[model samples]
Target: MVLDKFNSVRMLNTDALQADFVIVGGGISGVCAAITAARQGLKVVLIQDRPVLGGNGSSEIRLWMLGATSHMGNNNRWAREGGVIDEIMVENTFRNPEGNPIIFDSVMLDKVVSEPNITLLLNTCVYEVKKSAGHKIESVRGFCSQNSTMYEVTAPLFCDASGDGVVGFLAGAPYRMGAESREEFGEKFAPAEDYGELLGHSLYFYTKDTGQPVKYVAPSYAMDVTKTVPRFRSFNAKEHGCKLWWVEYGGDLDTVHDTEQIKWELWKVIYGAWDYIKNSGKYPEAETMTLEWVGCIPGKRESRRFEGDYMLIQQDVIEQRHHEDAVSYGGWSIDLHPAAGVFGEESACNQWHSKGVYQIPYRCLYSRGIENLFFAGRIISVSHVAFGSTRVMATSAHSAQAVAVAAAMCLEENISPREVYSLGKVSELQKRLSRMGQYIPDMKIRDEENLVKKATLAASSEYHFKGFPADGEMQALDESVAQMIPLHKGDRLGKVKVGLFVSEETLLEVELRVSSKPFNHTPDVTLETKTVSLCQGKQQLELTFEAVMPEEQYVFLVFKKNPLVQLQYTKERITGVLSVFNTINEAVSNFGKQTPKEDIGIEEFEFWCPKRRPGGHNIAVQSEKDCYVFSVSNIDNGIDRPVQSPNAWVAELNDPAPALTVRWDSAVRIGKMSLFFDTDYDQPMETVQMTHPENQMPFCVEKYKIYDGEGRLVYEKTDNHQSINEFVFPEKLVTDEIKIVLEHPSDLIPAALFAVKCYE
Candidate 1:
């Protein structure tokens, strides 16, 4: 080491690199975009200002990754966003079911590093953006604080996922900072001036018990929360981290430039809140508890929403409007917070949910003015009311996947983002995204290249609708419960028997209900009601409904709540069968039922949601006639998950060895085979702080073997727990027949598959 001369102006080391895509944020959206782009043969550079990836989802902030599933508090069934984000979430649940934030960090890091086409730069913040002619971004400049090095990254395309829109801001992209007026977009749910236009930033803290009393002293800057915060009494020792998402601030300030000030204010509130818990003598349970970790950076809810070709507005979300170029979907409620944050006297948030998932168009992904710039995450083009639904991590990540695929198409065709629409290539883009497991609502995969379409499919056995056997435990009728049954348009619900334990003679009321719309799961329309007389002890009660299904959809056979009655549950888990309860999950703002004010411009509906595994067993029922079918033709129905029907090929419960065969008139070369399994998409696989009962879905196939025309094993896998499994052969095989042998996760759960795709 040599001593530096005084006043010697030395330049920092500059490193230059080139890539196909430069994503300027390591949040879930950016991480997903990078992974998807890299997988599509694009060289990518992922830049993160923080020390780790996952942005708000990282350990530094610890916000749970949520989206369409909406905490299982709404009626959106099988609604988890898919693609790269799904893989990351599944991996997190398998490795860290305890939901430790640090372990989640490693999961994200591992996925990104595993891709050879990606170069990740952590602790590097992009500060400058260089633009070339024709409004295209030429390069970006970033500096790493830890290494004291500056990096100049050049790429054909750039993605601005930096929550605050740093690249878009410096690139002169049109954006909106606050909420838009109601007249501007016909948005009736627009916030008033008093409620504040912008959503705020929040900081979270975590606590734990040391098994001994711990003392805490307030700093000089710690404000007295008891005196300053109106909702101070709401704070307790039981909840921490994102559970206290309402513990927020900085909505009234410049969320971007004044972030440090907002962070300091949040710190003051957190410390003061802790001080009250310890010194105010209100929380005796907190005596042995101490602060384990507190977030230094705040999680921003909204910032600069940049402009795109078509801006998504309120009607797009509330009305579930269809888009021609639909590339993704969002199902989370329109959730907005007050500007005053924790200090506000009003309720922490106002959330309005839609009847079903709505499509997100591709036009809202790329910048309207900038040629090569793409917007990801909360900064995408959406009005304030629509943003309330699309701003969540999973939804944003889903949209980012659309951007990744669009970027790949752009590189392939050497065209601008707008040209993709002008040239009528959106369908091709959708097909590619669907192949990668990106869920686009109401859109089916129509790939002509899939060889399975030209072949005949047959299964060894198909499950017939009998009933769930009464072999599992029983639970009290503490809440209203219903069993979802699938029916054809003209089918009538016949006599059904349910096993129940009645304490005494009771008149149980059974009602048959269905959703007004075929796509919705909310049982809003009641068709028939039957009063069944039940005696004491365990007995079977027969119920018959004179109602015929209006369309091909799911109908709910509901049992009214009776405290003296208990219903028997079965261990069998199926792909599209679930028992939902009329209950409250306050985390997602589902308070049993939603009854909004007349002028709020929101819908009123009941929340019928499924419970997590190890508890969400199906109710025992018996029927003389078959009501549901699991045909082998469902494997090539284009639809992956269950929508109007089961959309899955399920084996019979007694099938010892379930197998599927595909045959052709002549041998054809096949290079790759993709199989879509049932991973219980209805449950929200929260990325952090939410423990799951099981790592692998009970309906998923655990092991499988594939054989060719010669009866030689081509590929086999065990210990599988992913929604999609792809096998690429090193040498293309010519086979007239292909057979797949499957193994169920357990005896109770049968082997099931959504779709099978083979390509040459």
Candidate 2:
């Protein structure tokens, strides 16, 4: 043990530890990375600076998990992240449907603890690095304030899931920060001039009604909103939690280095805003509401992004560019926030979506210079323009899973992260990922062991392939409709197509307005509009309006309310779409209703009564109008999962025992059979903010039986969760025919099965 003190610095003795992989940061990305590696039989040590997991989604920060599937919206379609993130999202929905923060923390922690190979060290900050020759990492030293322990962790592989890319920064990996110029990435949305500004940091607060009258007092540090804060004067006492993502600051300064100052400044603003709500004569409704929670940690949006072999740019996202080594995908939109933070009067940020979700490549997951350094989360190698979409937690988590799988391959191949690209190990890596249910855009199952591909699918019940329709149900003429219309980045508003119904001859006016800011959904800035008269009947209307704008956070296409007319919409709640009965009426849009609300159908997101109890859905897809789920077979014709359901064998069931019997032309030795069940493909996963309950879906196959070619019962199971189920045999079943006898299909929709395969 050695101790040294120099001037004003003190160093203490350190402990030594070793693992196959060391993950810095416990955010979704890091957590998923650690789990993936550990699950693949690698030893891992995960170091989180904070006391809890989930990073931004932690109770300390409380930002909900956002990802590749933009809440099952138009852009991303059926995309919900798979692997560990999907597990968390599904579990969180069932156990913590209210999207409770502490519950989310526990869920994430439980997942980490479930992995025996993962060594989790919470409240440990990795501060130093040790590198050896060959440009490879040797070890990293982290300090734990909880126990005053300085520990050195050594690993052959390292992943910087840390959102700030701290490991890459310490390892001398080349990186970039702040906005790029239009000339740098050929991004039209990029600032015409280069700037050292970035998306800001944000703070949030929580408030609850005391039930009885409650008084408020201002702290000494609370700024007087009427004087100190002038730009945002609207301090509604009821608004709290993540609904206030706009309470942002610190973009103009160094978001990483100046984080403390930003925290202090955000504290002032949050406290001041609370004080203004209680002390100011703004409203009498504030009398009963009490300050419930104030954040100590600020939720940071952007920071240092490490350099990788290929830097993804805006055009890649805008054009939905196809990368040869595509590994993961993102579709959250190019969500760029303003540099001025909260003080700026400009739109909070600029955002543009792609035609659809775009592919993220393998080259961007590992460092270009640092031999063993790989990164996930917001730090992945992407231009500032591309980061807007890749930086979300879900996309980063997918990258982490990709890194974890690649790290396993690296261990197997005895190669550096750079070498994997050169040796063409990416295809194998992609195969491994998809077999595990991670959806890589355009990547499909092509393995010869997928025996079902060569078999004849026979079922007792017939699955009538209905042509998918744009509109499923007739909505009642109850309220005005305004949907968030997203455009590909830098694209203009060419037109909008909507399904409408008129009970009698009626006149209707549609208005398109740009979202006020990047951080919120309230519409402002009128664009183009039109008025149309329709005869009594159902009609598909196309409203063509021209507008000039770089991009939009979101656009509001407000359809005027008419008593005699109604619009068509899937009652199933689609992600990314926000429904408003009337923003002006407090009752119409209150986050906290006077009484606890009931679990309404995805239909509640609609202004009309939620009547549809979804029988089966991948998610309520807004487009890709086909009666049957699109491109269900493994062959990809541009559209796949999230945009279309997987190629699955489904049946329309009325028989007591319905079955899908796979028969090959000849007998084949089969020792084991695996199946990926059809859980709700369109699972509306939410982390902390939701109006509905996440429950253990009954839509899965609850019971099933297996039979041999002779129709002899071989295996049977009842009460199942839709995870991959594998049946193994001591000796190979030398038969070409196998059958699945299914019972009690939930939701009464089509009985569906995904990824059926036989392996020896």
lDDT of 1 by residue, 571-649 (tens): 8778888899998998888888998876666788898988877778889877766865578988888788888778889
State which candidate has the highest lDDT.
1
- State every prediction's TM-score relative to the real structure: 0.98, 0.79
Angstrom error at residue 341, model 2: 1.5
lDDT of 1 at 584: 91
Tell me the spans in candidate 2 whose CA falls farther than 4 Å from its real position: 1-14, 192-196, 466-474, 477-502, 506-563, 566-646, 664-673, 697-699, 707-736, 744-748
Model 2 Cα displacement at 721 (Å)?
4.8
After TM-score superposition, the amount by which residue 488's alpha carbon in candidate 2 deviates from its true location, in angstroms, is 26
Q: lDDT by residue for model 2 over 1-760, one digit each (tens)?
A: 7645455766576789999899999998999999989978899999999999998888998988877545443323346777667777777877786788999899899999999999999999999989999678899999999889999999999999888888889899999988877777667767533333588889999988888888788788887666755465656866788778778888778889999999998898888888888877777888888999999989999989888999999888766678878888887767777676666666565545554567899999999989998998999999988887898888889879989999999888899887778998888888777766687765554665566666776667544332223545655545555655444335455655667778889888787766433322334456777889989987877666666544434555677677787666543322123333321212122221112133210111221111112322211123322123211342222222322223455555445676777788999888777666655544546688554443655545768899889898888888666445667788888887988887746433445566566776
